[model samples]
Target: MKHIFKFLGIATLACLTWSCADIDKDEVGDESKLPNAVYIEGADVNPVTKLTVDAAGGKSSFTARAANKLGSNVTLKFAINEKALEKYNELNGTHYKLLPAKYYSLSAENLTISANNISNGSIDVNVKPLDNELDASTKYAIPVSIASAEGGSLLNSSVTKIFAIDRVLYTSSLRQNGFYLKTTFNPPYTNLQEWTLSYAIKLDQNKDNQAVLSPDFYSRVTADGGLQMKVGETDDPKAFAKTKLQPGKWYYIAWVYNRQHVKCYINGTLDTEFDVPKVETFTKLNMSWGAFVGYVREIRLYDKALSAFQVMDNLYIETPENPNLLFYAPLDKNTGIKDVSKNHHAIKVYTAGSDDATEYNQSLITWQDEKFPE
Candidate 1:
């Protein structure tokens, strides 16, 4: 009876050992098989992709790929995920608005990975051009996600991709043919005790001794070869310097004024400063006197006086979007000018040789490539 019981116990132990070995073998075999997951190629480096494009023409694209080699073909489905965009916006404290799905389309909304080319297959995501009226500062985004995968699993870590779009700021060159753009001063300069006005200009030497910027009450520059500022309706304009500017050469001009004093800077160097009694208001800004011809780039107005360092730092920036900036005219469009400031001021253009003789004449205005005078 003892021998029979031992034999039965040994047989049961052998059977249990064989069952455990088989389970281990199955686990190893499964692990050896390549994982079947769809993911974006270079997701780590291109997690958040960005593209800058002109409003009128062009498209941007990126590729989505699958991981591992499979025995059969697999089809992956993609979709725009608004929820992913919302989450990203929340985390970044940004107002990156969503673009319409129509603006973007995949090479194949349903991408197929052939059995032979499983690891090498990919889908192309193309973004179409947007309207010119859209603000460049306001970023747009399209979040694309792998909605589903047939014969494969979607990679949880890299299932979604964020595509950001930024519009290129427009810039156009204008001739001195009495072409000038004007926009209202918001928070109006009427009550302000301090302010700064700055612009990039390249003057035609032939048009010397003409007013570069004029207000009904004052002129910022005169052909006399210096920065001039008039107090009230007074003819005795304060001259920054009698420095003759080279024609066809780019120059940065900045005027800072407070109740106590006014300072003028040329190319970031303080050229002149003078004491002045408190003034009431500055009404307008005029770019040229019909005969004055040159190029104008970024024109900015600040509510507060900017320091020399600030002026120098801002010289390199083609677009000045400062918070204190009350008015901005990039002068980038070929026909109609735009004010890219918070005020959304009205812009008026005056063209030379117009029969209408109106301040705003679209007929006579012409634009070319904005080239700063070297």
Candidate 2:
């Protein structure tokens, strides 16, 4: 299971104003003509990392930024070549594909465009693509041009000179039992209002079980004891009640808990919500899919609690061939799919050693906050 985790808010807006005044200038005299006069001095699009989905259900992201400077807010449209996406969908009429979970620095070859009468501009960017087994081959490039609203003619174009994505590889051997990920800090500070956990579970009373990304223990306000495993416990909220589970079968589970609220997603369905108190701290966090059938794959943990929509976005049934089991093997980490330990740390991971006892991974990921520490 891969446990995972941005910026650009009010401060960025203020900075935009100070650096680019033309963006806020008055529009053309006529509203209809406003688009015609609209010359995007600067535009960019970036995919949110970790959350980006690809063909194999990995992470991929694209980020775009544009400044109209034309006075009125005209839709700045972005078009991807038809071949750019896989597993495409049509929700209503708009079409989008699930981005791969890896990092990819798009290059000029990966993109195609035609533009009109504007020229003399440049594009600056930093990108990381999904696969880069080699250096010097290049993973990203900037495509900048001056043209009409419809990319018709190109006055000038420039490609990024040197693009590199910081490569990060998370180990897969850490998923086995006694394996826990812990950050700096103790209990009471591990409670985070924006943390989300999602994974698959299959418990086997007969054999060694596998649990994807189960929270060993959680304090649920609705639970009789105020704490319980995410499911299969009577004390848990009705949503988490473990009624009957079959062995050798996979059941999807998602839990979003925080100071602000709490909810659960079972088998891809937003089943229930309960008014739960914020949990500051507790210990002995252990999770296995269904009553000890501790088998798991593709586990993810987010620093911020996710909304229903975001939780749905996090679901990806596909996985890499011969995927790693323990540590995180991010397709790309340079873009921003990184550790959530900005402040606190509570994930402690242990692995089965040669002696059969558990061996610590040595690397301790600090909690972005200190609500719960091991």
Candidate 3:
């Protein structure tokens, strides 16, 4: 009887020990085991990121990260979610137009995060250079979302990332329907010896004789059906290219003049060169009906005669950063014109019949939908 009781006691003790060992193993093993929920590490903190680039073209980048470390490597896939972009635009009161998917490309569409990399795993997404065709006034966006993860679950709330391209205020196209800009020469320009005038123009119709740069005494014109530059009181005009101005085409026109010589350029090519009498002084510029009748953008004036290279360099108005630039008018304003140069000249618009003596009265200059000439 004593032996039987002893045997029963030992069996019960052994069973109890085995059960406790099993419980301990489950607690120790599963304590560090976490559910795989992957997400962009900075998505919650910075859900939206902004990028800016020149209208010319440039690249931008962003990053995504996993939520938890894993025992093995895992591949993650990402895609641009158009619906999410629309939602973001609506919520943020933004008109973020979606660029094509080709614009937003990932360095690795299927990024693999290894076990060691899981702790600090991240994937880079590169946005291809934006084309110059994009509208300067419009903001664009691309929303990236985690599509899938091989060994992890995606965090729904933090899966999406927003990237926006900032808007750039660039040159504006002006319609010919009687639109012109005049500057208030407060400290009127005077005592001019050497000067260079450059502008980009597109004419819808040619005028028999029209002033392009008329500053009281000195004038450059499309006179007698040709590009002309006149100096002195007698209007001794030097003409170039008898061919009529082509309608709806862009032309870069430049005039470099001094006391001894005058040079004209069209589209970076020297059109004409001649000797001219020196002019001692001149007044403000007048760009009314007799001056412009079509789209004119990026008008610049230099105090010194620009070299051939300088004129060619400024053919495309990328940025207004010339040291010798005295007056620059991007003419990119929606309501009124502005001189974005060191000399902030006052710009005033006028109606055709306004009694105001200082105003250039013509049809109101309306802003064109396209900022550049088509």
> TM-scores of all models?
0.49, 0.38, 0.50
Residue 341 lDDT in model 3?
Answer: 76
lDDT of each: 0.63, 0.34, 0.62
When sorted by TM-score, best at the front, the candidate numbers are 3, 1, 2
Candidate 3 per-residue C-alpha lDDT over 156-274 given as tens digits, one digit per residue, 9 for 90 to 100:
77788877654334455655444345665767666777888777777766665555666654444353346666665555544454344676777788878777587888887888787
Question: Mind giving the per-residue lDDT tens digits that candidate 1 earns over 34-133?
Answer: 3556676666455667654454533555455655466677787788888988887666544567876667677767777777454544555566777655
As a TM-score, model 3 comes out at 0.50
User: Among these predicted structures, which one has the highest lDDT?
Assistant: 1
Rank ordering of all candidates by lDDT, starting from the highest: 1, 3, 2
Model 1 stretches astray by more than 4 angstroms: 1-171, 185-187, 206-209, 233-238, 289-291, 316-321, 334-336, 352-364, 370-373
Which residue window of length 10 is worst by lDDT in model 3?
Answer: 26-35
By lDDT, is 2 or 3 better? 3
Candidate 3, RMSD to the unseen true structure: 20.5
* Candidate 2 per-residue C-alpha lDDT over 258-365 given as tens digits, one digit per residue, 9 for 90 to 100: 774567776656766664545434333343312232344334555556556455543432122211111222212121222232322344444533232464654432
Q: After superposition, how far is residue 131 of candidate 1 from its true place, in Å?
A: 20
**Candidate 3 local distance difference test against the native:** 0.62
